[model samples]
Target: MKDAKNVTITDSEWMVMRAIWTIGHATSRELIDAMNELEGWSASTTKTLLHRLIQKQAVAQHGGSRPFTYKPVVGEKESMAAAADDLFDHMCAMRAGSTIAGVIQSRELSRADIANLQAILAEKAKTAPEEVQCNCLPGDQTC
Candidate 1:
């Protein structure tokens, strides 16, 4: 399986990548035609993005020929997950403990969200010793 990189792409690139992910392997012309309505992007713009994607190793091309077929090197799900994680990590590092505290203190959550979060915490609290991978720092007491 291909490892997903924490690669950040522009909004335009994300639009194209999402479409390509949904559309499967395609040629530049096919991608441009399919995305034109959504992005109002010209064929040349699409070609440019394909070029950048290839350079980033996120997209691979058919043996360099006219109307070459291009496919994503990373799976859509993995890429999406990695991007979300990167975003969360950035936000956490920026806000420090306040980010987590805010989530814990929020009282306006929907019933479903609160219930699900409670269930997750309950499950974590009951985790057996053998299944635990403690990350408690020095001087920090074990749960």
Candidate 2:
């Protein structure tokens, strides 16, 4: 299994990964149908994407016979976290809190999710700095 942090998934590939992650394990036909229905992708397009994922070692093929089963070699949660981290890494560090706030406001989070976030925030607040430094520039300039 490939480590999610080490793998870089494209947006289109993330869609395929979502399907595979949801299904747990699936056949090529199953993936093709799902992609067609969800994204209106052609069978060849799905196949090509699958091939690329396999080469990346983010997915693995199983069974000896035809219609082999495919499963994710990378974990869904880990992949999502890695992707989020990658996005934040590119942005100014000072904007991360506001960006996170925007994301939290935009999404429909469950009560449990909210509570978990609250707990995390409470813990973090104890040691939280008064200000976040901007990393977008070489010196003290802010973005």
Candidate 3:
């Protein structure tokens, strides 16, 4: 499996990954059927996406039969975290707290969700460094 930071799953690829993740593992024909049923995509389209995913090391291919079964190389949580980090990294790090607060306030979180978020935040706060280093890109002004 490639490092999480190196994996880039496009929106279309995510759909295929989601199906494979939900099923735990699936063959090409099974994946094509599932994707077709869900999004009306052709077999070739699904195959192309699967091939790209495999090339990117986002999906693991298992052998031992005529048709191989595929599974997500990266778990959902890891993928989500990497995607989220990418989004935040493009924004101003200095305003990250405000940005996160705004997003939280925008969402209608359930009680359990709120509790879980609170616990996660508390744990993260405890381990957070006193000073964060800025490694923004040269052309970027939102450091």
What is the Cα-based lDDT of residue 137 in candidate 2?
79
Superior by TM-score: candidate 2 or candidate 3: 2
Task: Please give, for residues 36-129, the per-residue lDDT of candidate 3 as tens digits.
Answer: 9999999999999999999999998899886999988988878888998999988766668878899899999999999999999999999898
How far does residue 7 in candidate 3 sit from its true spot (Å)?
A: 0.8
Give the clash count for model 1.
Answer: 0
lDDT tens readout by residue for model 1, 20-131: 7888888888899977888788989988988887777778888567978888887888888887677665542334345555857975778898899889868967863534
The candidate 2 region of ten consecutive residues with least summed lDDT is 134-143
Candidate 1 weakest lDDT stretch, 10 residues: 128-137
Model 3 stretches astray by more than 4 angstroms: 105-108, 121-143
Question: Would you give me the overall lDDT of model 2?
Answer: 0.94
Candidate models: Cα lDDT each = 0.74, 0.94, 0.88
What total of clashing residue pairs does each candidate reach? 0, 0, 0
Q: Given candidate 1, what's the lDDT at residue 105?
A: 90
Best model per lDDT: 2
- Clash pairs, candidate 1, are none
Q: Is candidate 2 or candidate 3 better by lDDT?
A: 2
Q: Give the per-residue lDDT of model 2 (tens digit) for 48-96.
A: 9999999989999999998899999999999999999999999989999
